[model samples]
Target: MDEFAEARAALVTLEKRKQGLIAELNDVHAAIRSQRNKLEELIRRLPVSPINRLPDEILLRIFELILIFGTPRTEDKNCCVRWKGQLAEVSRQWRNVILHSPCLWTTIRVSPSWNTARIEAHIMRSSKSPLDIEISPWRNSYALKDRPLLRRLELVVPCAERWRSLTISSVVSSSTFRVLQRLDHLSLPSLTSVWIERFPCCEPGKFDLPFLQPQRAPLIEKIFISGDIGMLKGREIPSSVKTLAVESTSLRWKITSALLLEFVPCQRLTSLCLGNFTNSEELPPNSIQLPLLEKFVSRGGVSAALICAIVAPRLKHFECHELSAYPSLHDRFVAVGGKFSNVDHLELHAGPQRSQRYKPPSQSLRLAFPGRTQARFSTGNTLKA
Candidate 1:
């Protein structure tokens, strides 16, 4: 009887083990069914485009990058490329699309003074045909020396008349310059960008800046002037201009009440960058306001008091760089940096100063903090970086 009872107990243990294994198998099967059902629902909801089709807009936007990054220059005989690479790692499909699309390889950019014949060769070598060209004239070029490049550019670009977003800088004889007074003399309709850099910096009193009459391109919105700008009174800036960068090294600056009044026409302008404002004086008593001005950046001696005086109510951003007279102002006990009641952001460098070369220009010194004084800087965000 005892032997029969032990064998029966062993049989009961085997039955329990079989039941536990079956339960675990049932739980795994249910989990698999739940995952499969979720996957099927997701597959049904997903659109085919994300996996397969690319629209024309996306293709064009991808292709426009060639225009933006431009072509790369290389001396190796084995590597003739317009631009270096960037889009390759985006995806296999994009890499294939960019590689196959010639437009994505063609828009070539060369700095000024490049030999025109070589650029012509590069353009020819490109398997993908390009219609637009951007060239920076750092200096004149021999290859493009005689070509009707200005005219040819108009012909080659589809947006000619309205497509001229380029700058030309050359110090020509006073006689040749007379012919260029009307920027229309260039007569390329596609023009959009204008940069005029002149050497032997001229002042507004000596050289007349390039002028744009009332009916000039409706598209041109940015104008930058460097070198000597002749009396600006004769030239009427395009009324549509939204940005103006004007620089002059000459001390012939006249920041009188009348000059501030001249800023009225530029009310359409929102950004103004001025450099070399030489004098350490403020605006003449009551100057006209810069009604629409939002940002003002200057590079040289614009007085701390004068900036506060002239900057209108609408101004939002102000940056002053490389102040002219830290050495001259070091004799005073005043600080070297501070913010105006109006300005929210201010930057000042007590300019690595050593000693006073002359008397301080301002009655009070704001940016004059020295390391030994435990001085407090006025800029809320001031620290030596």
Candidate 2:
């Protein structure tokens, strides 16, 4: 019994010693943390290094440039959001610059797959700065369920008045774009540009997009649409728009002169691009007059009908691509060659072709332009003027 009692007392002593050692260890850790903090404070108080001596204005401008142009493709979409946080951690000076510049936080990219709280943080940090908002459809259409898509927009709709630009990309169906119908009532007073693109095969529903409506976004100046002509059906594009690019990249539809006249306020357009789809053969008896049109770009194929239809007296730059297959249009363009007499520069590019048969059309374009036009011809092989 005495021996057992001795063993228990020894165990108690060991336990007490362990507790004491643990308390001592904690004290040592606290002391180390205190010293580390003091070292950090001392380092901060030291004379700034030449590299860190850049003026705050210059540093802020550098940060803005980095935010605007530094997104690399390999990085995730949220890298910009991360950059603001990571840059702030570099030094107290950087943190102060980033926290004070609300414009740095105004480029918000919203996707159904991204976290809502992170988006909320960006909006909060932007304060009242005008926002460049992008509703990204990077995920497959199947992944963007109706509920989640609407939820994503719900966070942004309240900020509509501050929107400077809005890009809605890769929508694949009416159902996918239908969520935008929720925005029909919002007033986007500061919005100046809107770009919308749909997947190639989706139905081109007559979407009543709010930002392009005459009254909804009074200051809007540019509209770029990639997939559908019917996207302009319900809304009248405001006459304030100076640049209009309607590229029907899909084979399902062709942009017609009637359609262009119906939706686009042609007299106000200074730059027009008809892109990547087959040109319509049907034409009205009178050519469409674009009095102020200065730059015209037609891609994939430029048809004889279009060459005959558009009369741009102020045309300065004419850029046409994939002309190798359109030899017949070359002769037709020769018929209306006088229309572009004011054109200052003409660019003709023939995409990769099976044979050098592209050279004939390339030469024809050079000859087709009026004597005053400075022509550049490329057959995807050689560049000659």
Candidate 3:
């Protein structure tokens, strides 16, 4: 029993020593960390090197270039929200520079899922700089009562005058239209471009916002609308718009050749793209002459008769996709010869010969102009000119 008691006492002494050693080791680690941090601070306070002595203006320009070139591709796996934070983390001076530079924060991309406070900070940092705005749904679905999205829109509504470009994609909620209606009361003189792509789930003719009126966005020169062009009918699109693109899945119900004739100003259009129109029989009695049109792109069930009807004297490039099986339309286009006489490039995609589906079987694109024109063919089912 005495021997066992002695062993127990010895064991207790060793455990006490072990605890003391552990405490000493922790103290040593803390001291090392403190010393390391002090050394880092001293290093940071050292004089700037010659390479780091660039002018503030030059540094600001470099930072702007970094933001532009460092834009993450949509397919990139990394989180896009980290890009600005990563730039600021490079150094204390960089963080200060980024914070003060309003131009760096001018372009804001907001998703419904983003934190509201972060988005508010972005807007505040942008100051009075012209904003290029892009709003897309958080996931594939933007519910009608999404509070985050509504709050974000409320924050943006006050800055409508500073908006240079506005792009909204896959927004199906009725609340989106309600938010856009606020624009009707505000003048967007600086707004130059507007692009809206509605979600496929949204019913046709659901996007008839009064803000689409030409007077609200007087300076808008480029307009692209996808899904249901019906709202555009009888609505006076600005004659100053130079580029117009209309794409729809249900073209027959939404867009017609007559509607195009009534809405689009032939004299002002420089680029026109019409997608997914299945109308084969409706051709205007008189051929609409587009005097300034340089590029024309048509896709998906756009009848060859409709192609032959439009006259563009200065047309340099003509691209047609999923043309009907009517070979006579091609003959008529070649027969007229003068309709697109100035066309330097021509792209022809033949529709499926067996089935009446919209898919094309073969694509033949040619650059007929005599000069050294470079033709690049992208390897895909769709053809481009």
Best by lDDT: 2
Model 2 local distance difference test score: 0.75
Question: Which structure is stronger by lDDT: 1 or 2?
Answer: 2
Error of 2 at 191 (Å): 1.4
Every model's Cα RMSD, please? Answer: 17.5, 8.2, 10.9
Ten-residue segment with the worst summed lDDT in candidate 2?
199-208
Give per-model TM-scores.
0.53, 0.75, 0.72
**Residue-by-residue lDDT tens digits, candidate 2, 31-65:** 99999999999999999887489998899899998
Cα lDDT computed for each candidate against the true fold? 0.49, 0.75, 0.66
Model 3: runs farther than 4 Å from truth? 1-51, 76-81, 138-144, 171-185, 199-211, 251-254, 279-286, 354-385
Residue 139 lDDT in model 3? 49
Q: Per-residue lDDT tens digits of candidate 1, residues 156-252?
A: 3333343345554454423113213323344444444566555233344343332354454555677776655544534566777778877764445
Most TM-score-accurate candidate: 2
